[model samples]
Every structure is written in C-alpha cells, then in structure tokens.
Target chain A: MQKKSRGGIFVISAPSGAGKTTICKKILSRNANIKQSVSFTTRKPRKGEKNGEDYYFVAQKTFQQMISRNEFIEWAEVHGNFYGTSRKKFEGLVSSGFDVILDIDTQGARQIRNSFSEGVFIFILPPSIKVLRERLQDRKSNTKKDMQRRLKRAAVEIKDYNMYDYVIVNDILGDSVKKLEAIITARRMSSDRVDPKWIKDNFLR
Target chain B: MQKKSRGGIFVISAPSGAGKTTICKKILSRNANIKQSVSFTTRKPRKGEKNGEDYYFVAQKTFQQMISRNEFIEWAEVHGNFYGTSRKKFEGLVSSGFDVILDIDTQGARQIRNSFSEGVFIFILPPSIKVLRERLQDRKSNTKKDMQRRLKRAAVEIKDYNMYDYVIVNDILGDSVKKLEAIITARRMSSDRVDPKWIKDNFLR
Candidate 1:
C-alpha cells in the first residue's frame, strides 16, 4: 500500500536583518513542500501592511483574550508588542501535507520545540559579529545605540546554536539558500519517514 | 568554528538481472558525492574479471580464516561461492566524508544496516514478475532450471521491499537513475550529519 505523505514544521530563527525573511520568501516561492506560517501580532499595522497577509494585527486586549483562551501554539511579548502563532492554523497546514515554516524569536522557537519535539529547527547566522554590526548600521534604520544593543544581544543568542538541527552562515545569500534547501530535501527522506514495506517488497530474499 | 561536512551511505539491493549494478555505475559517475564500495569475494574469477578492481579474490581457506577472525562486515555463501565486504576499506571511505554506495544482495544489505544503522537503504524492483522472468531467461548464462529458480526467488524477494528507505521501479533506466540520485542527494543533508551550529550563532537571540 502507498503511504500517505507526512508533513513537518520547519522553524527558522534568525537575528533581525539577517535576510531570513527574504530567503523564506524565495524558498516558499520555489518549494512546493513548504508553507509559511503568518503570525498574529498585537501591534498597529504600519503603512502598506495587510492584515492576515503580513500579520494578523490585533489590539492588546484582543491578543490577551486569545492568550487566555489558549489558542496559540506559542506566543511571547517583544518590545511592548505581543506576537504568537495560532495552533489551529499550524495544524491545518501540516495535516494537509505541507511543511510549515515559522519565522519567530528564539523563545517562541523553543516553546514550539517543546510542544512538537520533532520540529526541524534551523538557525541562521551572520558571518561574524562585526559583519552583523556593519549590516545593521548599513541598513540606515537603526541608531548607533540600537546597533550596539543588537550586537550585544546577538552574542548571547549565538551561544544557543548548538540547540538547532542545522546552522547556516549567511556568508553568501545563494550558498546559504543552497545549504538550507539541501537540509530540507534530506530531512524529507529521513529513516523515520521511510516506509519499510517498500524495502521488504523490493529487495531479493 | 567551521562545521563538518555531511555525508551518508546508500545501500542499493536488487536481484541479479534487475540492472542494479548498471544503474549504480551510472549513478556514481554522475554524483561526485558517491563512491562505490568494492566487495571481497572468494568466488573463482570468471573470464574478464579483474582482481581488486572488480572483486578482491581470495582463496576459500583464507576467506574462512577471515570469517573466523571477524574481519569482514558481512559474508554469505551462494552456490558454494563466498562474498563479503572488507570492514577496513568501508570505514576508511566513510571517515573521509565520501558517501559509499554498496551494490549487494538483501542479506548483505541487512548486515550493513545492522552494523551501520545510519546508512540509507534502497531496493530496486522490476516492473512485473513476468518481466523479471523474461529478463532472467534472456540472460542465456544460466540453465532453464536455474533461470526458473532465480525467478521463483525474485518473487520471494519482492515481499521484502517494505524494508527499504526507498524503492525504484526499473521500467526505464534513465528515470531510475534520476530517482536514485534524488534519494542520495537528499540523504546527504539529513540533520544527523549536517551541523547546526552556524544557525544558532547567526540567527536567534
């Protein structure tokens, strides 16, 4: 009998402005197996941001109500804003045989891992802390103080690299994408996912 | 720190005349990541068989001595002829980060899996039992009874296809090679081999 397709959740965590969003966009556009998870955030929508597409923007009271109802797979507050993933949405995507990709903070990532022990956790890294500082400064969006704060926080974050399933350095965009794609492709054919019946029926006795 | 390269072993098993060896040859020539694991056998060298390159030919007494010493990874007798894999050679290739491909029988494949639980196993099947019988009959190298015996043996072997990581139906040679390549390529990126350190240091805080 043919086995049914099984889907997994791919949790990709990266420091701010490390190109995780862009890479995820490219992969989702190319890969048929992946579905990106849109998060719900209790923050005012910025100009050009579409609700339910960019994020499910809600008021603080509304987000707290959802939290009280335990509707989220995982949630956390950052910079006075609440961000969370809906458990129902995540389950719907996986049950349909599409691996869901979650772009979230490390705390959220860990929570998801605790809930789904087999979730594929991938961490993205900059080539170096110095390069990261330069990239953040180059963006012209953050103040010098803001850049310094991020770099300092990044040092602490880098220590958790060992907790992930795959670590990719953003030394080059194209190469990093190749490495990520390779990881996803290989994980799909893992021994746990293989059907032993296929082997027993084909190999000579 | 620089991450280690990820590699994997792919064991391909098929009955005689199923074209596994030919497909393996094409696959190795195409994939730079794969290297063939040449087996050691005590069978008398048929005409045109080259020593070391084809099979490591050894005397029956020497083969038995090696078996007693536990020098071979797996050994089995077929038609009073002995075949086995050299453990040292296989280990050396694997430690060097080259994915080794084993073209062997089901028994040998099972032994390899037991010894190397991490290896990816694939089984190849003919399109139908009728096609398998016709292919064996056309070989002309075996007697009619021998051909019938092999055909009967193949049917029993087909029952074990469920034991493999992947199965290829060898109706077309080109498509079969592509399928094998995809499986191997995917196997190399599994989380067990690929390092995740870079991801933690760069991405999550």
Candidate 2:
C-alpha cells in the first residue's frame, strides 16, 4: 500500500498587529495542501470582506442557536461580537487531507484544544515593542494611549506562549513564513501520526 | 535578551545499503550547523578511512577500557567489530549549540534513546525493494547469499521505522534532503527547546 497523506489542525495565535494574517496569507497562497479555516462571526462584513469567503456571517441569535446546538468547535466574544469555528467544517477539512490553519484567539484556542487536543498550536511574537508600536500605528488607532493599552494587553496574552507547540518571532516576513512552513511540514511527518501497524502491513510485509 | 540558539541530538537509523550514507553526507556538506557524531570502532581502517575522520580506529583493548569506564553513550558489536559513540563528544557538540546527528544502527539507537530521551530519531526508508536491490548491487559486496541476507536483515530493521520521530522515503534525493532540512528547522523552534522565561524577559518586557 502507498503511504497515506496525513492532515493536522494548525492553531495559530498571535497578539493584535503581530502580522499573523499576512504570514497566513503567504503560506495559503503558496501551498495548495494547506487552507485557512473560514470562521463564523456575528459582526457585519467589513468593506472588502466577502461572506463565506472571509467569514460565515450570521446574526447574534443564530450564533447563539448554533452554540446551543454544540455546532462550534470553539467560540468567544470580542468587543461584543461573537466569533467561532464550526466543528463540522474543521473535521471535514482535516479528514479531506487538508492542513487546516485556524487563526484564532487564545481563548478560543484553549476551548479547541480541550476538544481537539491533537491540533498543533503556534504562537507568533513581534520582534520588539518598538516595531509592534509602529505596526499598531498603521492600524485604525494611532494614539499613544491606544498603543500602550494594546501593548499591555499583548504582554498579558504573551504568557500563553508556553502552551504553543512552536513560536515564531516575526522579525522578517520571509523567514517567519519559512518557519511556519517547516513547523507544519515537520508535524505532518511526526511519529505520533505514523502507525507502526500500517508500516508493517504495507512496507515491511 | 535575544532569542537563544538551541541544539538537539538527532539520531538517524537506516537499513543496510539504503543510501543513508549519501544523504547524510549531503546534509553535512550543506548545513554547517549540523555535525555528525563520529563513532569509534575496533575494526582496522580500510584503504582510505582516516582516524577520527572516517571512524575513530582503536584497538580492542582501548575500546574495552572505554566501555568499562562508562565513556561511551552506546556501544554494540556487529560482525565481531566493536563500535561505540562517546557521551563526551555528543554532549560537547550540543552544548556548543550544534545539532548533533548520530548515524548509527538500530541497536545503538535504542541505547541512545534510553539514555537521552530528548533526542529526535529519524528513519530513512527505500521507495521499493527494486530500488533497494539496485542500490545494493552497486555496493562492493554483491553475492546472492550476501544480498539475501542483507535484504532479510533490512526487512527486520524496517520494523523499527516507527521508533523514529520522522520517516523519509528516499525515492528522490533532492526531495528527501529538503524534508530532512524542514524537520531540523521546525525542531529548532519546538516549544520544549524554547525557554519561556527568556521569551517573557526579552519579548514581553
């Protein structure tokens, strides 16, 4: 028998303005084997966001109903907007042999890990606070107070870095993308995913 | 504080005449950060085998002395030839921030794993018996009995492939090398190797 392709759930977490979205975009565009998990959000789509493409947009009541139905793998609220990952979709993508990259928050990630403990968690960190401040400035808010508040929150969230399987420092974009790719590739070949019985039946026999 | 460099012990095992030596030579030549763990043997050096370079040729008396002193991390006898790897050399290379790769047999690999559970073990497999047969024909010994014996031993060794952290099918040389490189790169960023306090002290602060 030929070797079977194995897929894994990649849980990628990062603080705000940590350049995770850009890295994820580059990885998804280059490798057809990998795909980003399209999350469901109660908030309206932004100007350029597409429904089902960017997110599965739904009403707050609908999201609550799904949650009650236990449809979500994990869900959390951000700024009063509910966001979640659909369990059915996640399992479907993985079983189809696609590496599913979930760009989710730590809170949601914790919930996912409780249910899907096999997922590989990666944490992205900014090179320095100075660079983080500059990146945050490029966003909608540019005030010093806003930057400080965000930085403080980032420091708090950084404690969970230990929970990740890998950590990438976003100093250079190309290097960070390469690191992410390596982590995914390595995990795909991890012995935990390889069954000795299958090896014996196929190759050894 | 800057991110610290990490070094690990990579234990690589392969069956006889599986093209492991060539792949290992390529990896060593390309990656300067990776160093091979030279083994000491009681067998006399062949035409071009250099002392300490090819195999650390030693007398039987000296080998036994070292073994009795507990200087060797792992040792085994193959075809009446005593061979061993030094604990001192392995420790020195890793502590110096170099990834130490031990190209040893399954017997030696099992010993190392018992002593150093942190090491990453990788097993290389041939794509097919036809390819392996062709590769074996190119080697110095090509008698029918020898070939059968080697192939039988190879099948037995193939069962240990699951003991490795990763398995690379050596169908295409370039692709296998790339996969090995990715495994090493990803392992460098593994959370078990990264110091959490260092991250908190440097990045978070």
Candidate 3:
C-alpha cells in the first residue's frame, strides 16, 4: 500500500499594514480545501471574535502550561500577550491532506521555518513605505509615537523578505489575492507532491 | 543602479496525445508577455503551417551549418529530419524580459535541461493511459501498428514526468490552463527574481 500524499503548509508573513490578512481571507473564502490555522492566544478577544474559530482564547496560565508541555509548534509573546500555534492541530490538518495557511509575522514565520522547512514561505510587501505609513496612520488608534515605532519595526521586518520563497507586493488587494491563490494552486501541482502510486497506476500500467 | 530581472524560460514536455500542444497554444494566446520559441526544422511544413509562426522551416544544409556554428541551444534528428532551437533568440527574448515557452518532446526537453538549468520544466499527462490510447487512435493517419508503437513510447516518456518541476494531469482543459497560469505567475513573484533596488527604495529608505 502506498502512503497518502501529505498536504503543504503555506506560511505568509508581512509587516503591519501590508494587507496580508485581507489576501489570506480572500484565498480562504475561495478555496474550501485550504484551511487557516487558528492560533491559540492569551490576548482577550475583541468584538465579534469567537473562541476556537478566531483563536483558541486561553488564559495566560493555560498558554504557559501548553508552552511548558511543548505542545505549541511556535509561540511568541507580543505586546505582553502570548500567541501560539498548536503543533497537534497543525500536524493533524496536514496529515489529513488539507492545505493549511498560516498568517504570521516575520518572527513567527522564522520560528515556523526552523520547525517546518517544507513550508512555502511568502512575504507580502506594501507598495511603498509611504503607503504603509499612510495605512498605519489611517488606523485612528495609533498615537504619533506608536506610529513611528511601528514604522521602524516594519522597516526592520521588510529586510527579511529575502528569506522567503516568494514575495507579493500588496499594491492592489484583488491582484495580490490572485497571486496568493496562484501560489497555492501552483504549489499543489508541484512534482514533489504527486503521489507515486497514482503515476504508476495511470501511466506505468 | 539595479540590474533588470531577466524573464523566465518555461519548458513544457509531454508524451504524444497528451494535449500539450493545445494547452500551450491556449496559454500563448492569453498571455501577451509570453512568446513561443519557434523551432528550426528541416522537415517540410504541413498544410496551413506558416514558416515562422509554426516553425522556422530551413533547408537541411542550413540546419547542419547552424549546428556546426553552435547556434542551437539544443537539437535532435528524428526520422531523417532535424529540429533545433536558436540559443541566441532565446537569450535575447529572456534578456528583454519576455517569458519564453518551449514546447518540446521528452528527449528534446532532456537536452535543453542540461543547457538551461534555470528553466521551469513542466510535464503534462493525459487523464490516464486509456485516454492517451484513445487520443492516439482518434488521429486518422495512425495505423494500428503506429498507434501501438506510440502508446509504448508514451509509457516510456511518462516516466520522465518525475524530472519536471511541475506536473499537471490534463483531465479538464480549463483547470489545467489555470494551473499553468498559476505556475507562471507564482514563478514571476519568486524572491530570486525581485529587484533589490526596488526593495531598498520602497521599503528600506
């Protein structure tokens, strides 16, 4: 008996305001076979957020315990709150042949790369630094100092784009979504993912 | 000053009756930036086949002269007729940033692979062996013996599918076309092809 082909993991990272979230959401809506890996977070859910759907909202104690038990594939502390992706959940999705998309930051993407080298790492770039700054300013909540700090961090993160396999400039939302979808579709058709048994049965026989 | 990104070479190969020609035609028609590499052939052009469009029809002497001059990137003699691709033309197209698609057979593909290692090699498969046999039979010129020989050759060629970067089973015409388009788009977005100066100007500074 031949082993089944495992699904691929697509890791997408971007600096803030690069529109990675919107592109990922569009991809998920169009592709039923692709699932988003909902993270576990100790941060309190905002309005309309659902536990286990948006995130596995757990208390800080539970998050710490899970980290201590080594259950998280990659976990990080951000803004004084913990966010993690469950190793069990991720492996389960992939083993069952469902493509999983992880929308993460550059740091989280780095950790995932260390653990899962097979994953397709993609970096999303805002059209320009000026555009990114304008988008951040439009958020209405960030103070001047906060905006400057975020911009600095974004510049630092953008330098890591070279580490990724593919990069998409988020100038237009629809175009970026299509490019993301293309990446997912093309990755599905890679020769490495084709089942040897299927090839034998269809052509060799 | 940053160097311009060169265009990619997409090499597509398939067994006889696998519908590679039709798929390539559709891709060329839809994509304006892509140009087909018209091969130089010593064989007489069939009815309705234009000299430069379908192929570059040349005399056997001319073909041999060009071969001696080392102008052909790859060439092969089959059934007393010679076919070759121009290395200079291909490089010119790529340098001008126009993606070039070469539709060749498995043997020709293998030869090109040795010369152009950076090309994206894609193999197209029929829905199944049964479908391939039927397609060959549908060709009115093929005798029973010819059909059988073609089927045998196809089986041999199919094994080379593993060597390709991407594989598409031509089960549905529309689906296969989309997959091919996706591969091309995703490849264009690869980090290797990105202009570093654009990154530095737009994000770093």
Q: Please, what is the TM-score per model?
A: 0.79, 0.93, 0.94
| TM-score: model 2 vs. ground truth | 0.93
Candidate 3 local lDDT, A41-134, one digit each (tens): 9999987789988899999999999999999888877657788999999999988888899877788889999988779999999988889999
lDDT of 1 at A170: 74
Cα miss at A60, model 1 (Å)? 2.5
Q: In candidate 2, what are the lDDT values of residues A57-142, reduced to their tens digit?
A: 99999999999999999998875789999988988888888999999988998997888877999989888777887899988745
* Candidate 3 TM-score on chain B: 0.92
* Angstrom error at residue A45, model 2: 2.6
lDDT of each: 0.76, 0.85, 0.87
Which residue pairs show backbone clashes in model 2? none
Winning model by TM-score: 3
Give the top-scoring candidate (DockQ): 3
RMSD of each: 4.2, 2.1, 2.2
Provide the lowest-lDDT 10-residue window in model 3 chain B: B1-10
